[model samples]
Structures are given as structure tokens and as C-alpha cells.
Target: MMTSKIIEYANNLIKLTDEEAEQLSNAFKEVNIKKRQFIVQPNFTAKNRYYVLKGTLMAYVVTDEGHNHTITFAIDDWWITDYNSYIFQQPATMFIVALEDTIVLQIDHEKEHDLKKSNHKFETFFRIMAERGLASHQRRIISNLTQSAEERYENYASKYPQIVQRVPQYALASYLGMTTEFLSRIRNKRVAKKS
Candidate 1:
């Protein structure tokens, strides 16, 4: 199955057997979502971590001023969740939405913990995932504090060219913590330089 590939990647890292892989896959439930649909909304509880089998999704926080601050993006083979909510069993502060037609496999909190208890490899996989997530979030924070908006945009473009191509300019601007107009000017400047 599609989710097996994701589990396999972790399995290989933690040396899980085929039986474990089968159990892991069986624990997940698949679902599809249309573009512009919400998977989770702020103030509600987030029950599962969604693994993307296809398409894209994003998590963001919207302020009273109505500005969206993009937290993260999930593409094929990636995972999306409000970790704070999931871990603490609290209401989510972030909104998770589909950017395109999406297919995801989700494992609920209970199943996730059960899997870890059942398989040492699963525990290792989750540990590695958390570490990588922390590292990525740290990079975002450092970049925001140290880099110019244009530089940050450039780095994001370079690092996630696929997302850059797929996401709207406005959304990208929000993720870069800049205005759409400024992002447009940056794009224009790049275009002129290329000319």
C-alpha cells in the first residue's frame, strides 16, 4: 500500500520486520480531501497525524487581524499535525487545510502510542521524526530572526522548489512573513535580473 512506503522508510531506519510493517499499515485509515477544504480548524481538537499519500496540505494560524502565518507544509510522503494539540490533548490553535486534492493515511493518538509500545522500531522512528521536526522548526525561527525577507524567500524557494511552484504567491508571502506586494516585487526583481 502507499502508506507502506512511508512505514518502510522508517522501518529501514529502525530495522522493523515485515510483520511490523503490516501491523503499522493496518492501523492507519485512508481518506481523501478536496482542495481548499479544512482538515482541522482552530479551537477544535486534532485527533490524528495525517500522512500525505498525494497532494499538499498546510498548517497555519490566523490572527484577529486576519493574517495567516503558515507553520508548515506537507507534500507527498510527508506528515501533518498540530503536535501541541495532539501531545497535550488540547484544542488546536492551528488550521490544517488541503492545498490540492489530497490523499492521507491517519493514525489516531491511541494507535500511535500503541504502535510504539508494540514495536521498538516504531518508537525509534517517532523519536527520529520528532528530532527532525524540532531541527526544521529551529531553522525557521533562526531564519526569521537573522535573514532578510528576500533572503528567506530565496532559501525557501531553493529548499522547496516544488512547493514554491505549487503554492500561491500570497501564501508563500505569508509563510515568509511578508506581504504579497513585497513578494511580488521580489519576484519581479528576480525576473529582471534573469532578463
Candidate 2:
């Protein structure tokens, strides 16, 4: 069961009553995703929110030209989903992919609503979670607009070291708005200088 982990994560972010926590756990199901697997994809609707229990994942969009741009990365204790698609019942514009063989706790929309109805605190939890997502999105936009490629890479390396190791260099390069060749050059420079 997800009782312990849910309580732990919820307590860190938002407090939940005992009964509310139980209900929240009941709504969750453990799921495993293989590396490079798509958890959510464009043109399809997302019905669940996933909390990373192990390993890492990325949510991204791919252009018609086959260029991919990653939008978000989730690691242990982090949540991911195409919220707009899940909440509005529309097609997803992004795809969420497992960066490594991973495990996640998933809660579908219906179960989430049922849990929300059981307590105001639970509803508040989701509201806060959404707000955090918005804030993260805004921060990413500002960084992309103002930071240099090297600066962005450094920011990610410091902030999400686990992601740096679990995700492919190509995917990380796309997210940083740099070509794989440039990213490789930077990585090589770092390694050579360290040695």
C-alpha cells in the first residue's frame, strides 16, 4: 500500500488528516514503466497523476520535424502528468517517458475526485500541488529565456543530479535547447578538466 509514502510526501508538502491519508492511499496503484516507455503521449488523454517512487521520467513534446523538446522531469517524490489533458478531458500535447526502468504510484481522475470529496484538506493538497506545477513551469520559461546553454546545464546538474545520470545526454541536450554535439563537448570538457 501507498499509505506510508503518501503520508510522507503529503506531510512534507501539505498536511492530511488520518482518514484523508487512508483514502488517498486507497486511490493509488503502483505501476512500473520500462526505460524509454511512454507514460503519456500526444493525441491521447491522460487519466492519471504519477508520483515517482523510483528512477526518473521526462515529459516532452515532439515537433512534426521529429525534434523533441522536454518540458519537465520527475524524480523520486515528484509528481507528473499532463494536467490540462487530464483535467479538461482533452488530447495531450505532450508525452511523458520513463528515463530508466521505474516505478510510480498512480491515481486516476475519478479516484482523485472521490478522495477530494472526503475532505477539504485533500482538495487543498491537490490545489497546492497544481500551484507548485505552475510555479515550476514559470521558472523553466524564465530560465530558458535568460540563461545560456552552459548555465542551464549547470542549473540542472546542481538541481537534479539524479536526472542527469538517468536521462540520456541527447534528451538532456534537447531540454537545454542545445544540440547533442554541443552537450557532448561540454560534458567532455568537464570530465577532462576534472581528470
Best by lDDT: 1
- Report the number of backbone clashes for model 1: 0
Q: Identify the leading candidate in terms of TM-score.
A: 1
**Tens digit of per-residue lDDT, candidate 2, span 103-189:** 999999888888789788788889989998889889888999999888888898998887898788888899888999999988888
Q: RMSD per prediction, one decimal?
A: 1.2, 1.5
Model 2 spans > 4 angstroms off: none
Query: Any idea what lDDT model 1 has?
Result: 0.88
lDDT of each: 0.88, 0.87
| TM-score quality measure for candidate 2 | 0.93
- Could you tell me how far off, in angstroms, the CA of residue 194 lies in candidate 1 after the best superposition? 1.5
